[model samples]
Target: MVAVIKSSASIKNVLQYNENKLKQNVAQLIHSGNYGKDTEQLGFTDKIRTLEKLISLNERTKLNAVHISLNFDPSEKLDKETLQKIADTYMRSIGFGNQPYLVYQHHDAGHPHLHVVTTNIQRDGKRIKMQNIGRNQSEKARKEIEKEFKLVQAEAHHLKQAYEIKPVNIQKVQYGKSDTRRAITNVLDVILPTYKYASLPELNAVLKQYNIVADRGKEGSQLYNSKGLMYRILNDKGEKIGIPIKASQIYNKPTLKFLQQKFLQNQTEKQRHKLRIKNAIDFSFVKRPEQSLQELINALQKERIQLVLRQNDKGIIYGLTYIDHQTKCVFNGSDLGKPYSANQIQERCNQQMQRHEQKLTQRPAFKHANEQKQSALTTAEENGITFKIPGVKEVFKELIQTEQEGSLAAELRNDELRRKRRKKLHH
Candidate 1:
C-alpha cells in the first residue's frame, strides 16, 4: 500500500478533473469527525461553500485544499466491506475525519485506490496545523496503515517497477548518434496505436518492413519488450479506434520459428559489427605512429572526455585528462602515451584492487543480511505476526485470514477482481 498527499490552494481546479465520475461513485458516509450533520448534508459544492461561509463568518483566512491518495494492492483477496473499512481506517488514522474531507473511490486505474480532498481550514475557522509535516507525517501515516492492513512492508528505498522508454542505440546506422532518440520518437508515434496485441512475429514483421526490430520478453504473461511495442487498433490518443488483432490472428507464419531466426541474425550482425570496428581502429593505430595521439584522441572521443594540451615557454608539453566534468590529472606527453612508473601504476592498481576487495566483502554481507531479513519475515508471517513501516498501520495475519475466510463476499467486492482472477486463471 502507498499513500501520497498533495496540498492545493484551490479546491475548484483540483476536483474539476473528474467531478462527474467522482460524484457518481460516492460509496458510503463513513464518519465526519468535527464538522456537523448540516455540514455533512452539504454536498461537495455546498461543502466548499460552507467552508467559505465559515471563513467569512469568523473573518479568518480563506480555506485552501488538502488532497490525499491511498493506493492499496488488493492481491490479498479482501472483500468490499473490508476494503471500505480499511480505507476508512486509513483516512481516520491520517487525521482526515476531524477535518472537512471528502473520500472518493476511483476505479479508473488497474489497482483499487482512494482519493480524499479536504480544506486546510476547519469549520471553526482555524487552519489545520501543518508544518514540517511532509516527511514525518507521511511516513507515520504509511506505517500505521500498513500495520492496520497487515501488508508486506516495503524497504526504505525499494526499487519500484517503472516503465521507461529509452531510445535504442544502433551501431553502423546512419543516425547512429541519434538512433535511440529517433527510434523512440518514431516508434512511439507509429506503434502507439497498435501495440496492445501485436504479437512478436507481427511486430518484427512490421518493424522489418520499416527497418525497425521488435524485441520480446514477459510482461505478466503477455509478451512485451523494452520498447513496449504492441499492436492495437487504438487511435492516436489510445482511445479504441477499432478492434485489436494479434500476430497469430493476422499472419499465417510460425511466430517462434521466425523470431528465433531473427534473434540469431541480429546477434550475429551485432557481434560482427563490433569486431569490425575494433579491428579497423587497431589496424589504423598500428600503421600510424605519428598519428598515435590523433588515434588515441579519436578512440577516446567516443567516451565524451575532454583532452587539453599545455605547453611551457621552454616548449615542453603536458596533457590533462578531464573526467566527470572536472580536471582529473595532468601528465607529461611521454607519460600520457606509455605506461606509468612501476610505483604509479602499482598505486592505481592497488586502488582498484581495494575497491574490488571492498565490493567482494560487501556483496556477501548484503546478501546474508537480505537473506536473514527475508527469513525472519517469513517466520513472522507464518507465526501470524505483522510487518509494517514504523508509523503506518500494522497488518496482522488475522486480518488476512479473516479476509480469505470471507471468500464468498469476494465476488461482490468489485467486478475488476473477478475479471483479473479470471484472466489469471485463464492464462
Candidate 2:
C-alpha cells in the first residue's frame, strides 16, 4: 500500500472532484465520518456546507483542506469492508481519528484506491500540524497497517505498467456544451498534477492525447506577452472546436505563472530521475541500433516516455525533451548531460545514416564481382579452353581499398563537422 497526501487551500475543489466522479458512477462514497448523514442521503450543497463548516472553524488557516489517496496493489482484491477499515485505520493513525473526513472508494483505474477528503481545521478552531505528515507519520502508519492487515507490502511488489486515463471521445464534447468543459477538466485534472512536463508545449503533448491543447494565441499577441494561456478541446482531426477556457479560470489554476513555477521546481526535483532516464535511452539503442529520429520516438513510446524533438525552420534538429511517465519527471536532453543532448543524438543519427549508406554501397559491388567470376568460369567450361582460375588476392585487396576510400573519407569529414558543432553547442 502507498499513500499520497496533499494540502489544498480550497475544500470545495477537492470535494467537487470526488463528487463529480461519483456523478460519473466511477466512484462510490464508502464512509462519512463526523457528518450526521451519508453522502447519498445528502445533496451537493449539504456535502459542501458540512465540510465548509469544519473549515470555517479556523479562519486564519488558509491551507485547510487535506486530500489523500490510499493506493493498493492490483493483485490485492480488497472488498469495500476491507478498504473502509484500511481508511479508518490510516486516518486514526495519522492523528485524524477525531477529525471530520469522508472516504470514497474509487475504481477508475486497474488498482483499488480510496480518496479521503477532510479539513485540517479542527472543531476547536485549531489547525492540525501537517509538516512532514507523509514522510514522518504517514509512512509509519502505512507500514503498521500493512503488517496488521497482512496486505501486500509495496516494497515486495513491482507495480504493473501505468494505466493512463483514456482520452475523451471527440463526438461527445460538442461545441458550446458543458460536457466539453467537463471532459476537458477531467483530463486536465488527472494529467496536470500527475505528469511531469516542463514547458507549455510539453504539457500540450500529453494534453493532445486527450483531445485538448493549450494555446497562446499568436507570437506577438497581447495574450502571449502577458503569458496568458488557454485550453481548448480539439476535434478528432486535432482542430480546435470548442470555446477556449482561460488558464486562470480553471479549477486547478493551471496558469502560465503556475506552470512556470513548476518548471523551475521540477528542475531541482527531477535530478534524482536523470540516471533512470539515461539508462532507458541506452537500453533502447541497444535493442535497435541505427534508428532515425522518428524510429527513436516510436521506440521510446513503448517505454512510456515521450521524446519531443525541436527543430528549426530549416529542419535542423536542435532540442530534445524526455517525458518519463514512470518516474513522473521531465528533462531536457542537455540537462541530463552532453551525451544525452540534442546535438549528440543528431550525431548518432548521422552515424546510422552513414553506416546504412555504406552497406548499400558495398552490396552491389560484391554482387557484381561474384557475377563476373561466375561468367568467367562458365566460359572456360563451355569453350573447352584450359584457362587457370587465377587467385586475385592482391587485386581484390586493391579493389576494396579503392571502393571504400570515398565513403571512409566522407565519414571522417562528417565526424569532424559533428565535433565542431558539439564544441559550438557547448560554448
Best by lDDT: 2
The window of 10 residues in a row where model 2 has the poorest summed lDDT is: 156-165
Error of 1 at 93 (Å): 3.4
Tens digits of per-residue lDDT for model 2 on 169-287? 77666734356666776687667656666777767767886889989889999999988998888888678986788877666566787678666655676688888888878887788
Model 1 vs truth, CA RMSD:
31.0
Q: How close is candidate 2 to the true structure, as a TM-score?
A: 0.61
Candidate 2 clash pair list = none
Task: Give the per-residue lDDT digits (tens) of candidate 1, residues 232-306.
Answer: 322232232222323332112213443344344343333322333334334544554234344444654454333
lDDT scores in order: 0.45, 0.78
lDDT of 1 at 66: 62
